[model samples]
Target: MNTISVQEADFDVGAEIEALSAGRCDVGAVASFVGLVRADTLAGGGDEVSAMTLEHYPGMTEKSLEAIVAEADGRWRLLGTRVIHRFGRLVPGERIVFVGVASSHRGDAFAACEFIMDYLKTRAPFWKKEDTPAGGRWVDAREADDSAAARWAK
Candidate 1:
């Protein structure tokens, strides 16, 4: 079974991988990715983003992530997958995203990890609000994210 979680609490990447691989013999490769809150925006906004608040549509968000994982499962010979995205206020050093994929081969595992992240950036319902020195502002979605997701289109 695949697992997807959106929580305000932090998670341990090593523990998550151990849990997923435990008692599973078929899994040969596990590829994972973790996203962190960067200090600066891509647009070169001089104002340093001190904090970021992530918002999600709850039920819809989980469903969307599940669908993305399902697609990865179908495209590759995946044994398991896990995605944990955090919400609420996050500082620069905090982890914002996690994607893990287990497969029989490294290629599949690598592709699945990248695929999940790409889909999550564009397909997921999570939005960000940045707290800058000037004030707070809602972050707009980037076109590059859309283009990344577009690569997976059939």
Candidate 2:
């Protein structure tokens, strides 16, 4: 399942992974990645980021994530995959993204997880606005993110 939620609630990473791998005997490995709201950006000039509001094009966002996951499935021996990304206003220490990959071996699981994350960072249509003491600012898309995604090119 590829899910994009815009809620003020918290997500449990352990629960998500368990659900993704449930009852799958063929899955010998599971790799997961969680992204959190950091207090600072790379610019290093903002106040403590007290909260962040994530926005994305609804239908388009899920489609983009599904495509990324599909690419991973095609490239690896994946048994299953789940990606959950949250939008809306979120406080510090809140979970931003969850990526889980299940495969028959450790190598496939690890590679698929990294591939999904790298693709999402650039291809996904999510944007973040951070609340700081200086005020709110929209985080710009990073060039490095594009470069990361490019490594998976055909």
Candidate 3:
């Protein structure tokens, strides 16, 4: 089953993976990625990030994530895919996003997992505001993320 959930609560990675591949003998490989909130700011502020708040446009966010997964499904022979993105207030070490893909082959599963995360970094409609010692600041889109996503365009 393909699942896409956007919630404020944290999720269990093991449970998600188990659910994705349960009773599926054909799934030989499973790849997953989990994104977390960092305690330090990467924006060169030299300040500690205490927490962060994520916001999204509800319906649009889910649609965009589903589209990304569909694109991956079109590209690979995937058995199943699951994407979960968390919003609202969160502290460092908390998970922000999770992407998992199951496939018959390792290569397809790895590539699909990476592809979904790359697109999520650039295409998702989520916004983040970090609470740092310096003050609250909106996280800017990084050129590195754009470049990473662009590589999969080919």
lDDT per residue for candidate 1 within 12-102, as digits (tens), equals: 9998887767898998898999999877764656789899999999999999999999999899999999899999999998999999888
lDDT tens digits, residue span 83-107, model 2:
8888888888889988888888999
Query: Ten consecutive residues with minimal summed lDDT in candidate 3?
Result: 39-48
- lDDT (0 to 1) per candidate: 0.91, 0.83, 0.93
TM-score, structure 2 vs. true: 0.90
- Runs with alpha carbons beyond 4 Å of true place in candidate 1: 41-46
Give the candidate number with the greatest TM-score. 3
State residue 42's C-alpha deviation in candidate 3, in Å: 5.7
Q: Mind giving the per-residue lDDT tens digits that candidate 3 earns over 9-95?
A: 999999998887898699999999999998975656678899999999899999999999999999999999999999999999999
| After superposition, candidate 3 runs with Cα above 4 Å error | 42-46
Give the C-alpha lDDT of model 2: 0.83
TM-score, prediction 3 = 0.96
The clash count for each model shown is 0, 0, 0
TM-score of each: 0.94, 0.90, 0.96
Which of the predicted structures, 1 or 3, would earn the higher lDDT when compared with the native?
A: 3
